[model samples]
Target: MKVRKPRLKAVDFFCGGGGMSYGMLEAGINVLAGIDYEPNCKQTYEHNITGAQFIKADVFELQEQELEDKLNLTKNDDNLILIGCSPCQFWSIINTDKTKSTKSANLLIEFTRFVKHFNPGYVVVENVPGVLRQKKESGLEDFIIWLKENDYKVHFEVHNVAEYGVPQSRKRFTLIANRVTDESIDLIKSVERKVTVRDVLGQVNGFPEIKDGHKDKTDFLHTVASISEVNKKRLKKVAKDGGDRLGFANDTELQLACFEGKDNSFKDTFGRLWWDKPSPTITTKFFSISNGRFVHPDEDRALSLREGATLQSFPKEYKFYGTSTSAIARLIGNAVPPQYAKCIGEAIINNHLNAV
Candidate 1:
């Protein structure tokens, strides 16, 4: 008679819109529940991910016992897994207005508290690379030390998601810990091939060309942000493949004031992507061409909400709940790309299986 493999159950903390949860599910892990502070994520998380409960609450206020009771988790569950990807705004290099002194600087520490209390068999954390730089303020270094002291074998590194089959060049900090085995585990691996914009979006149909500020009547999320008449003309003059605002650098009237006198620092803004290349990191304001290299390669507009989500490795069928485009963008941009998360989940599962 064949023996059944032990089930691996997981709980996701700071689980924004179920990205990590969805990935873990894809990896054959039974994700029990997701906890997040944002209420807007409730519908999106519960709608797409089956058999998982979405608890809307701040992680700092959540008690370990409450989580244990909520998920019916016991201390003896040998295959229990904990996943936490804390909010990283305060630790992001792009967040210039805020410093490490902000209130959110210590969210990782709060996440560590749960790790200490539950002492799960496995723990996984994903954050921005800036988190490592904020060693003094964010307590990331101390957290790693504590994990080792508590008898958990931990490994962490910065990864470029493009290598993991995501069609975006996003860099992230990832950590994986296990109390089960001493065998070495690696999260980074070479994929079959790097995914490009054409590889993913080339054959997608029904995406009609939309003007600025117009929502597709058939697909609501296929809407584009409003562009000014001047910017519209500027976009028109740009070449289809990998064109940028620098094309008009010689035109004093059309050039931005910052670039008037040999200032070419921000060339990535108002730029179009190359079809054969992976996209630049999809930011929250990806719908605006002025934000980054978000312009459509062949279209005269910035990326639509659906395009942004696709670049972030979200499935086409996944739905997002928000009153406005910006709100939805926040959810998509902040999410750990589901494809990358699946790679990490696979690593964890492989490590566990090898150990057992």
Candidate 2:
């Protein structure tokens, strides 16, 4: 008789829109639940991730015993995996006003509290590269020390998601720890080739050209933001196929005042993407031309919500719910690219579960 393989299960904290859980599920792991504080995420998470329970609460307020009881987790469960990708806005390089993020800066440390209580077999953390450089007050260094002292074998590094088949040039800091064995696990590996914008969006059809702020009549999420008449004309004059705003014919008069008189600071703004290259990192304001190189390579308008979700490796069928365009964009942009998360999940299965 054939023997059944032991089951691997996961619970994701800060599980925005279920991206990480979706990827783990795709990797054949049973994702039991997702926890987050955002009320808007509840519908999106439950709708997309079929079986996983969505718990809407702040991670800091929930006790470890409550979580363990909720998940039916026991100490040192060999198949248990805990994922925590705490809110990174405070630690990201792009966040200019660090002073306002004082509350968010401590969320990573808050995650460590659960780690101590549950003592799961495996733990995974994803965050911005700037997290490594945060001051001692943030508790990142201490977290690492604690993991080591607990007899967990830990490995961490900065990885480019494009290298793992995500169609974006996003770099993130990732750490994987396992207390079951002394052997270190490596999550980063080179793919055969990079996934590109053309590869993912080339054959997508039925995306009607719409101005900014107009939702597609046929598909609500396929809508683009409304563009001003002046910007519309500027987009038409853009060279196309990766052309940038700097290449505009009359920058001083047409461009924003910030770009007057050889002011090329935000050169990527109002720029078109290259078809063959991976897209720039997807952000909440990806639909606006004023934000980064968001213009389509061939089309005259910036990317729609559907296009942004596709670039983030969300399947066509994955549903998103939000109050407005910016809200939906926030859900999509803040998610872990499902493809990259799948790679990390697969590593854990192969390195630890299979080894057992």
> Tens digits of per-residue lDDT for model 1 on 69-156?
8888887455998898988878888846675537677788888888888888898989999988777678889988998997788898
Looking at candidate 1, the ten consecutive residues that score lowest on lDDT are: 201-210
> What RMSD does each model have against the real structure?
1.9, 2.0
Candidate 1: RMSD over Cα atoms?
1.9
Model 2 agreement with the true structure over 1-356: per-residue lDDT tens digits: 55665778999999999889999998888999999999999999999887999998888798998988887889878789989998888888894777776788899889999888888889999988888877376678898899999999899888999999898999998999988776877876647789898887744544556556767644337877888889987888777878888666475557666677654577788899899999999988898888889998887788999989989999877888888888999999999999989998998888765454
lDDT value, residue 333 of candidate 2 = 92
* Residue 146 Cα positional deviation in candidate 1, in Å, after optimal superposition: 1.4
What pairs collide in candidate 1? none
Runs in model 2 with CA error above 4 Å? 1-3, 188-190, 203-213, 217-220
